[model samples]
Target: MDKRRTLTESALLLLVSLFVMISQGFAAQQVIYLLTAVFLMGIGFLLPKSVNWILILSTMPLCYWWPDIAYYLPPLLRILSMPTKRFEAATFFVYSATLLLLPLSAYQGIIVMLLAISLYLRQNDRAMTTLGQDFLASTDDHWEKQQQLALQNKQLLDSHETQLALQIAEERNRIARDIHDNVGHLLSRALLQIGALETINQEPVLEEPLAQLKQTVDTGMDHIRLSVHDLHADSLSFAEAFQNLLMIEHLCPVEIQGSLFTDLTDKQHNCLSMVIKEALTNTLKHSQATLLTFHFKTLPAFYRLQIRNNGIITNEQYPPKTGIGLQTIQQRIRLINGQVHIAQTDTHFQLTITIPKEPTK
Candidate 1:
């Protein structure tokens, strides 16, 4: 495109020079006009966009020395200016050159107008091309940012799902341990006692019923063992489980202190797990908290768990109304013979639970 534009400008310069030579019919005057016009045109073409103003300045000499034919120079100057500046330059040249050339010939006035219009339109086209490139660049940047945000959201969701699954698996294992350790042990002991009773008995009538009872006890113990094995398929430490729960990004910062794990009855573990899950859910759904803390420890014959959060309390009054979730939590604690206390203030909510290391029969 640049090469074509150069060729076109050179051709126009040649045509204008030939016309001036024919019209003036003076060799010296023709040589002066031709050289001045060619020099200005060459400077305009050579200067980069950075030095376009120099090209504009070059036009003054043409206007002064060759006032009669100065209208030919503005079109040549248009080549050096950038797209955004082209329109203004074209307008200036048209008005300035017309003042000098308009009275000389009606033909000259028409030619100058035609050239100005062509320059203005070409500059406008260049401006549009530049604007289109900028628009495309902005759109591409926005698309890349959107893609990055979508990928982050997907990763967050995957992490949340993995944490919830781990919680479920841990709960299952605890259940299996409870059944095997409590029920299986009791049944096996009963079967042994029945066998000892059989050896002491001397009656044939008592032997049949004793054998039947032993078979039932043996079967129950076997089933309990199998179920316990199935439940123990996956086990996660308490510290790791807590870490996963805290992986939820938008939630407040969580701090877990004291012992993360210890030996506790299945019932106590289940109660504590339930409370933690419910507390986290409530915090996410209703509480606008900035910090949460969990403190777990062993106190003599009791296992103690304390949870506190710096979230807005729904009610200002003491002894707040109990929802079904809280009622459920209380009921679970009662079943394990544990003590639960929930307290709330304007800026904080707290839950404290204490269960016996060995749950009641």
Candidate 2:
């Protein structure tokens, strides 16, 4: 039931109780009885009991011309359990007035109280039923909201899993193509040099180009080894990457400041490491300024990387014709679904990168 409806219904019952109690009692004693009943009604509403409502409802007989067993007044015992409700309260009021008229003895008011309580119980039970239905409806709505959240979470997980699989495939293809082309061709060239060296044992001068060939072979081998390790690992922890980045502080005149990384997930560590490397390379290649500062902060789901260089972006060297460094950083960030921002002005150049918690494969 609407809250308004419940209120209105209780009001009507109160009005009925007042009128009946006033008219049926002794004319002279009516006011006293009515007042007493009103006070008792307050108690019933304030503290209704199962037995009390029942008594109040049944005791309406006391408002009649001859109140019966307005006699056995003291038997009902209900003060202990009454829970307050309005209708039952009014019923007790009228019952009290009617009981005053009976006054079988000084103690007759007790019987009327008992009967008043009984009737109040019946009315209270109806109100409680309506209240129970409202409670159940609210519970149902709460359960439905929880179910919707669970479904949305499931969909998001499924999408992430699909993207991860696609990215792994792409990485695999890239590694395959690089190894087959660069490493394969370099090794093949090295083999030809070995054949030439074996057949032509002429002069020591012929061996110079073969030594260069051997150096190329070693470099190719090193590149292949690093590539294979990276392909398998897919991640670098915070300590390793941050330590590698810090190596610059000792070697260059640049003064690096601010807190080092405390902790980061494997993927976050990798993304930040790449961004730092790219930013430092750009600073050296583009700007001739000396000082560099890196500030990193850990957020709930991502990391914020800021690199500031005190070098001014000169008009001639700002690379407006071609920003290859900027393009490379942008591509790397995009691969992981992260964002990179480059701001170069007369006074300073800032590179800020935000990498999300879950990167694209």
What TM-score against the true fold does each predicted structure earn? 0.48, 0.38
* TM value for model 1: 0.48
Give the 10-residue window scoring lowest on summed lDDT in candidate 2: 71-80
lDDT score, residue 279, model 1? 75
Model 1 C-alpha RMSD vs. true structure (Å) is 13.2
How many residue pairs clash per model?
0, 28
Over 248-333, each residue of candidate 2 has an lDDT whose tens digit, in order, gives 64333555555656554444445556667767766666676777877777688876778888886555755732465565566556
What's the C-alpha lDDT at position 178 in model 2?
A: 72
How many clashing pairs does model 2 include? 28
Count of backbone collisions in candidate 1:
0
- Candidate with top TM-score is 1
Q: Please list the residue runs of candidate 1 whose C-alpha ends up more than 4 Å from where it truly belongs after superposition.
A: 1-46, 66-71, 82-95, 98-104, 181-186, 189-193, 196-200, 203-223, 233-361
